[model samples]
Target: MKVLVIGANGQIGKKIVRLLSPTNFVRAMVRKAEQMPKLESLGGYPIIGDLEKDFSYAYDEIDAVIFAAGSGGHTGADKTIAVDQFGAIKAIETAKEYGVKRFVLISSLFAGEPEKGPKSLETYLEAKGRADDALINSGLEYTILRPTTLSDDDPTGKVSDVTAFGKSSVTRSDVAAFVAAVLPEEKTYKRIYTFANGDIPIKDYL
Candidate 1:
């Protein structure tokens, strides 16, 4: 499968590229061309693209796309909306225009449910929530994986089968693994699921 990973320079994005490059035809999108060498070294076809701008060129010949890119720890709400919400929406639209088969989004936990989250994270969650809602109803095959607080720990390749959060945290690598695995599965298409490190079985949810 030919996969395009937006935000391939992020912490989790790098891991996803490394994991998918060995088997799939992976295209790592970066804002700058200089970032190409590292991803290329990892057996990825690096493409220079920006989420805040036009991404029509980036979608050429792409089969699936992983919306893993986001604006980092910033203070302004506009930046968050621009990068997280609007940027994600743009990517999805472009994917549809290009006839991409599957779209997988890396969203955060408590995205659509603001009442259960802290006040500070409410805006960020809302932005992701809006994007998730848009994709869910976009009439294209989609999967939204909402994961709890992310860590840099390695993946155990063991996913919790449960959908409810029970005071558990998931590693970033595990989230990336889940996104990679879900994109090719028709069973997970159009499903919105959440993930964490707790001992809940993910197979039951799938």
Candidate 2:
């Protein structure tokens, strides 16, 4: 599949680009020119674009789209809403406009509700949930992965439903792997599920 990854410079996005580039014609959309080489080194065709404003042109020539951008933890609520929320919705619309076959979103567990997470991050979560809702209502073949607290630990190549694992976390590597695995799987289309490290292998859950 020809896939376009938004926010290709991020912690999770970068990994997704690297994992998908070798097998698929992947476009890594970075916000700055400096990040292009990093993606090119991983075999990705890098494009410069920013989700904060307008960059729908990047969606051209892609069969699938992955919205993986974030405003980071240190940013304020405005940035959260602008990038995490508005930016994601914009991508969804652009994907639909370009006749993209599928859309995948990287979200977080406990989205929307401010009561379930840390006070500082609740706004970000709310924005993420809004973006997810937009995608669900957009009439596109979509899959949403809402993972718990992210870590840098080595991936186990295993994942389970967040409900089955309770409150938990998973490594960034595992999350990227899961995204790469589901892109071509028809079983995951239109599915919205939370994931976390567990005994069940990734394939089994998919």
Candidate 3:
């Protein structure tokens, strides 16, 4: 399968590229040309493009697209809307235009809530929520994976099958695993599910 991975240089994006490279043709999209070398090293075809701009060219000959890109740690309402919300919508539209088959979105927990935690990042979550909603209604075959508090820990290579409706935490590696696993499976299509690391078995939840 041919997969187009946006934000291929991000924490989880990089891991997804590594995991999918062996069997799938991956087009890694980045904002800068310099980042291409690292993605190419991972057996990905690095394409320079920006989420804040038009990416019609990046959608070429792609079977699936994953919007793993985000505006990192920077806080601002404008940046949040641009990268998180608009960027995702743009990618989805482009994918649809090119007749792409599947879309995998990495979203956040507590995305649609109006009340922000005392220490929670509000703008980012709000933007993610909006984007998630858009994708859900986009009439596309999509899978939305909402994970909480992303960490840099190693992958467990296991998923909690339990349905996580509320807030929780998980690692980037696990998130990438979920993205990778869901792509080739028809059972996950058009579903909106959330995940977290816990003692529960995935089979129990599924």
Candidate 4:
């Protein structure tokens, strides 16, 4: 499988590129030229493309896509809409145009119910929800992973599909592992689920 990982330089994105590169060809979509070397060293075939600009150049010969890109909290609402919402929607369109078989999205836990999320991040959450809707309506195979608040702790290699795990957190590495594990599984191709660190083994879910 040849996979293209958008926002390949982010915390979870980098891990996805690393995990997929060993088993699948990876096109790590990075924005800056300086990020190429670091991503390449992680076994990814670094491809330079900005989400805020043209990214179609990076979709050539890609078999699948993982949209892990985000504008983050510090960036204002406009950048968030530009990168997270429209950027992800464009990626799905590009995947359809390029005949990519699967599209996986890295979304937030309360994306589908943003009003219940942080008030300050309401705009960002809405963007995610809209982007998720775009992918669902695009008529392409998709997997949407809505993880709870992320943590940097070492991975426990365990996760569960628990939508009501209040204040629960998941490690970035575990999320990446989960994405890599399920991409080839047809059962997960069209499902949208929430995951968090839990006693259940991650592999069991896949």
Candidate that beats the other on TM-score, 2 or 3, i.e. the better one: 2
Candidate 4 lDDT tens digits, 1-206: 98999999999999998899888999998988999999999999998898777789788988899999998745899998999899999999889888886999998887857777877778888999999999999988899999888889999999876665356899999999988887888888778878899888887866
Judging by TM-score, tell me the better candidate of 1 and 3. 1
lDDT of candidate model 2 versus the reference:
0.87
The best candidate by lDDT is 4
Per-residue lDDT of candidate 1, residues 97-189 (tens digit): 899969999988888776677677777888989999989878889999888777777766666544434466788888877877787789999
Q: What TM-score does prediction 1 earn?
A: 0.91
CA lDDT of every candidate: 0.82, 0.87, 0.82, 0.88
Each prediction's TM-score versus the true structure? 0.91, 0.95, 0.90, 0.96
Q: For this target, which candidate reaches the highest TM-score against the unseen true structure?
A: 4
Show the colliding residue pairs in model 1. 160-201, 160-202, 161-200, 161-201, 161-202, 161-203, 162-201
Clashes of each: 7, 0, 2, 0
Cα lDDT, model 2, residue 182: 88
Residue 9 error, candidate 3, Å: 0.8
Model 4 lDDT at residue 51: 79
Candidate 3 lDDT over residue span 1-206, tens digit each: 99999999998889899999999999999889889999999889999998877888988889999999988546677887899999998988887789996999998766766364323467777888888988888888999987766778876655553333345567798888888888888888888766787665443433
lDDT of 1 at 120: 74
